[model samples]
Target: MSTESATHLRDESGPFFGEFGGRFMPESLIAALDEISAVYEEAKADPTFAAELAELHRTYTGRPSIITEAPRFGEYAGGARIILKREDLNHTGSHKINNVLGQALLARRLGKTRLIAETGAGQHGVATATAAALFGMSCVVYMGEVDTERQALNVARMRLLGAEVISVTTGTRTLKDALNEAFRDWVANVSDTHYVLGTVAGPHPFPVMVRDFHKIIGEEARAQVLELTGALPDAVVACVGGGSNAIGIFHAFLDDPDVRLYGYEAAGDGVETLRHAATITKGRPGVLHGSRSFMLQDADGQTLDSHSISAGLDYPGVGPEHAWLSSIGRATYLPITDAEAMNAFRILCQTEGIIPAIESAHALAGAIELGRELGPDATILVSLSGRGDKDVETAGRYFGVLDEAALAASALEQNALDANELTDGEAEAGELDHDAALTAAARQALDEASSRVDDLSAATGNGVER
Candidate 1:
């Protein structure tokens, strides 16, 4: 079973994965966390719990997500085959479902009737809401106000799935702020609420448990790739934010000496400009969000703001396990700039017709470079963590698709103004008051275009449509 070797049959002295990962939390919450840890252990031992989870994976969440080789997309990557593990096909359209379902089940076993979580791009929030709806639990998700605006579609998805979305406006109004708000809620509602830490970053048990839940990703991919190619891949790649998806897919290959593991962090503008979220590449070890890990902080040790085109990857700190993995030299961590990531995103869409999440696009960017370096004979597996439906608006704006529509609309308005024989002053300033109407029309055009693009993307299954 995957559970047996997810982190493998190893014994550790405590929750610390090296000098990182510990329960650095309030005294009030320690007992609750310990109870969660104990319950998870007991659940792992119980055949019934395992069987139930396995059934859910088989029927509900779609386990053993397939690996499809991207030959056409590989052409640009120096002819090295680009194989993708399609977690995007999972329930709720992301790898997050795997962890949330497991955690929700545990929450049920712990006699909890409510679930709480934090989201940046809203993938985790949607997954948590899905699980909550399925299990008859009330769900509340904290999202940064900025993220709520950026990923407004996902906010709608969460609400439609029966979850309350709270917008956190403090600080930079991003992931860290949402995280702070969630923790405060958990502290107050610990009695009847299970705080589902969306990533593998929080304190001890969450980092361990979330990774364990998702490790099946790598386990399945490892076997499927070996059977298909008759050898281990040259490299396994994933994007790192709070690092759950990366660790999930990387854990299975940790013992495979011949396979190289790589994690790509988001570089918003450029790391040189200090506007990126390349935590491991340029950050220092510090405590944030209850774990000691690589964090973007100032000289005075206050956490700094992190930026990324992908809201999911715009985080200042990463999971402690990633910090430990980078420290031990087991995996190489690097940066992928926003422009480069969008380039990969465009290429994948045009070449393979696969619209990957902006977060996953960072791994795609890395895969391109790795493929070029490794050449034609090499094989690289990238974790396509989610579908891009939630990102269509952002992508349209980034690629200027929406802008083109706006320009056309503006031209039409100008033509109408000309037909009305309006003076230059009337057109540009006073009488021809079509500014608000044009703006509304542009917004509608962008939304319609984004929806159409999303519909087109849905045609692709695990890979390109044949």
Candidate 2:
């Protein structure tokens, strides 16, 4: 089933999705990529390969991810039925496990003993490391230096799973840099290492293969939605980075012309500003990471630095198929600013008691906007792509929990200093009790923040919760 339904609409054999996808890689890696392509093509046709992979999904990766209707959350979004595809519950805590497991299987088929990958939010890295450990393969993950700091929890998880995590510190020191480093590493070590690209980008069969691996997400969701609602959903939504997860969930609905597909890209501050990764929304087609796709490039076609609060969406280029979809107007791509995404992030947590990754929050933000546009009768299915456990630190910092902690810590240190009679060299003068005074500063700040929240909640009973 899902395989037949997955590719029911278009051709997957060609190297191009319209005019956007093609092998724009180095000569040194063409043969390696071609080898991978051929192997993947063969495996795709082989029933045994499909059977094995399906078994893995069924037993290990957890296939048929449930879709839960968020009635409480939907009330905030113009009363539109908001159903969430719970990919966040998958075994590596994201839809990333779907592609990683399949790639690892293919790598085994190709006799590769190592898995090389690049990650942005580190979910992909964690998934790759997980599959590597499961299949007894060595794993190396490259991540941007900036991402490593924000996603320290995932970095620790990767190392604990036996992956050697390399922090890439080039250019913007984000996803693009890490991808560049991973490609370089793959080119040098193609003999025994399989570059498990985490998304539906890169060269030929990868976009096809990775999407095929994840199409089960849409396939299951489609049937589940129909079973639950007794009709098709009015729309489907997902956040797009290199575009694997979006493609996975979007593919099954492509044949249903009436079902709208919406992809949300990261707009760090605003699209008007230079700091955004809304590739499909504010980009032109250009080659990046071995394929021609919508890229944030300059007038002279040079790649531009992209920024987003979500490391996963901080890429300058998008998957080629997404370029095709946008070009054809089959799907709509929108920019979700950091503020919008964070607000939605807080809403989903307060409303549904589910913390989502910042990347997925973009889609949540879009859903609210789209739901209002479509009104109460429509049903929108949003992909909760990943859990927020790996993102808790970043979110906490964003919400000022870290600032509060630092203030309290500093206040306590000041108290310790005052007790030691070393209060800024005013010990003998005794001008003030530095401990209580400093602690009060922190307390005052905390009180002010609490008061603000309380004031808003009092004004509108539902304001603080959502």
Task: For each candidate in the order shown, give its overall lDDT on alpha carbons.
Answer: 0.89, 0.89
State the displacement of the C-alpha of residue 3, model 1, in Å, after optimal TM-score superposition: 23
| Model 1 lDDT tens row, 156-224 | 999999999999999999999999999999999999999999999988798889998999999999999
- TM-score, each model? 0.86, 0.87
Cα TM-score of candidate 1: 0.86
Instruction: Indicate which candidate wins on TM-score.
Output: 2
For candidate 2, what is the lDDT?
0.89
Q: Model 1: which residue pairs collide?
A: none
Per-residue lDDT over 1-466 for candidate 2, one digit per residue giving the tens place of the 0 to 100 score:
6578344555444488879888988999999888988898799789999999989999998887889899888887889999999999999899999999999999999999999999999999999999999999999999999999989899999999999999998888888889899999988999999999999998887788888888888999999999999999999999999988899999899989899999999999999999999998899888888899899999998899999999998999988888988988889999999989988998999899999989999999999999988999999999999999888867776664444545556666766666566655555445455555666776776676566555544544344443
- C-alpha root-mean-square deviation, each candidate: 7.6, 6.2
Provide the global lDDT of candidate 1 against the true structure. 0.89
TM-score of 2: 0.87
Model 2 residue 278 distance off true place after TM-score fit, in angstroms: 0.6
